[model samples]
Target: MSPAHAGRPGQAIQIGRDYYEGPLHICDSVTSLLAHYLDLLDRGAYEVGEGDDYIGFVADPYESGFDPELLSGGIPHDVPSGLQAVLIQVNAPRSPLDLTPLAAAHLRRLDLKRRPVTDLTPIRDLPIESLAVSLHDGDLAPLEGHRHLSSLDLATNTTIDLTPLRTAPNLHGLDLSQATVQDLTVLADFPHLRYLALTASQWASLLDENKVPPALAAARLSKRDASRTEALSWAARLGLTVGASFVISGTLTSDSETGRTQ
Candidate 1:
């Protein structure tokens, strides 16, 4: 709604009667929306911190930049079409601000049990680190500019053939929990990888404790009722900030806050 189109005091502005409506008057192109949106954000129109509740709001990327896939139950599955993005907060609030839109598929929380590693493929020209494009049961096909990705969160996504990761030089963090991942040698491709969280991952067994010599960013690895000393020791050796946590006999625990390794 524009100011010039304001009808007589308190009068409703009907689309048909309100006047000729088109780009001639006001066009909501990506640029326009982005300008207003950023202004709103700069002035604090919305919260600055987000956690998990925000999903399906803006399910796609801005019309301008390269957008990634918004997967749902499986590979062929996707979120509602017209959706763009959403606003919410993660369960663990890092700051009072809630500014996470989860763009490019940075999915943090939700019910994904139904979404299994699938019979589908990843989109082309996408994969921002913040996005969560986890392939539940399939492999993410390589993109044109594969190494440009910043982060790829495929936690618990099994059946993932991360050949694409070889090209993802920009990749920094990865969450492959309970998924089918075999080697970190592929990760050697990502020299800048800092934060890594692999808890009870399918490849946990395959991971040669020696391979994960830290020197990266913060690391969080946990498994079924595990004694995190082993993982922590490896993390320390690599110079990574380690925060090991996991579930044990229905109880949740972390090595940092708790002294016992239950």
Candidate 2:
């Protein structure tokens, strides 16, 4: 298909089984795009088009007996030309995996959640805007120079130093939930940061009015303790006047400022 006939070549496109006739269009979210691709893979109808841009594949070891090698080979060679985002989710073998096929200089986003990948030296120079990875004692020095990065998810990484993030001036959203970071002072470097997530216990440490970034707008606290009164109290002090939501036994219940479960 001609570049003009196909929607904007830069628009995000999710690879799926559906026989789409024209250029791909943007999807509502990356999660939905991944679901469409997984459905296509199940139906054995997924095909990579020449004009395709963003694409993702998820392999569930328990359900589909996912083979990392097979998934790697399935990626088309043309994907490197204009591909923007490449999300790969794999299970088992907690070791770094080389994703040479998906490595493109123009790539803008990458999500390797729950994957065995540890080393990120390969794509360190790419102008990526968003990145999510699960690293276990892996070197994070590669991320030090990623100034274009805006959204980062290091939730699965336990041991990490926030010092490297000082260079990422464009960072806006960050996820450090379940991480082993002890210092909240490092966040003062991110002048543009607005959204943050961390363990409930870390809320107290970040409550220091002088330490919290002025632009911080919202926060998601996971692993919440039985009583969130202290957390909410801290939030109130930080000028986060918004209400809170509580997840109990997988059921989310909106809570008012009075601590009443709505």
Candidate 3:
């Protein structure tokens, strides 16, 4: 099989049980990673790969905790329907950094463990044809150069600002839930976005199919349980004017700062 390439932000690339046939591109920054040189890597160690058929990569930091052996070398994650992509989680114990030298390693590259208390730069522009930003159930820092994103899943990352995505003309799918974002004016800027899902109280307002733009077609919104909902109610009560035809799930928070804690 050729080098495995990651999909665009939200698009799916054709793949077999062990191959990803996207645009067949890779990044120069990755091929140079130090992890490429070691014939054998330590579990929870950094990984690397050559560009060849490789499109881009994902960085899940949590994986290091669940499977310490994943860090030893390239970890390929083949999702349902022959879909190949990376699945990185937050940082956990026994995870390494600086994986830029293992040319033989084409990794699933899950886990984004490296997060600073003050800030985190958003992803920058890359040549990736198909990529999946599985920031699901996680928090995302500021994103940078994302010029070639196609399928992006910011789901569960309610705090992330999708405005930067306006630059990604190829974006098709987007998901942001459980995050702190109140409005989705950023999505209105995209002319090509096709599918979107906001399954949280925070970003529910962005699902307005009417005012959200014509490119949008399918969407789903879910809220947390009574033990879950919080500031989202204000948007609904105030009649912020969002989308329709979607069942409202999740909980609504109490009134006042007293409930701020447990």
Give the candidate order by descending TM-score: 2, 1, 3
What C-alpha lDDT values do all the predictions have? Answer: 0.44, 0.63, 0.42
Candidate 3, residue 137: how far the Cα is off, in Å: 15
TM-score of each: 0.43, 0.61, 0.42
- Candidate 1, superposed: residue stretches over 4 Å from native: 1-122, 126-129, 156-159, 200-209, 213-215, 224-234, 237-262
Q: Is candidate 1 or candidate 2 better by lDDT?
A: 2
For model 2 the TM-score comes to 0.61
lDDT string, candidate 3, 1-262, tens digits: 2343443343322334554333322322333333432322434344445755532223432222223334333333422222213334444433332323212333332233331221222223233334344343333333334555566544333365556667666677765553455457666777888876664543445444334745766654544453223334534533455444355677677758677632
User: Which ten-residue region of model 3 has the weakest summed lDDT?
Assistant: 114-123
The weakest ten consecutive residues by lDDT in model 2 span: 60-69
Evaluated at residue 84, the lDDT of candidate 2 is 51
lDDT of 1 by residue, 1-262 (tens): 2333211233222234433421111223446646756666566555434685542323223322222343321222334322222222223222222112232342222223333323223334323224453344456664324544555556443445555665666567667664566564565455667877676443344255445523365666656565667666655555656675565577766687667665
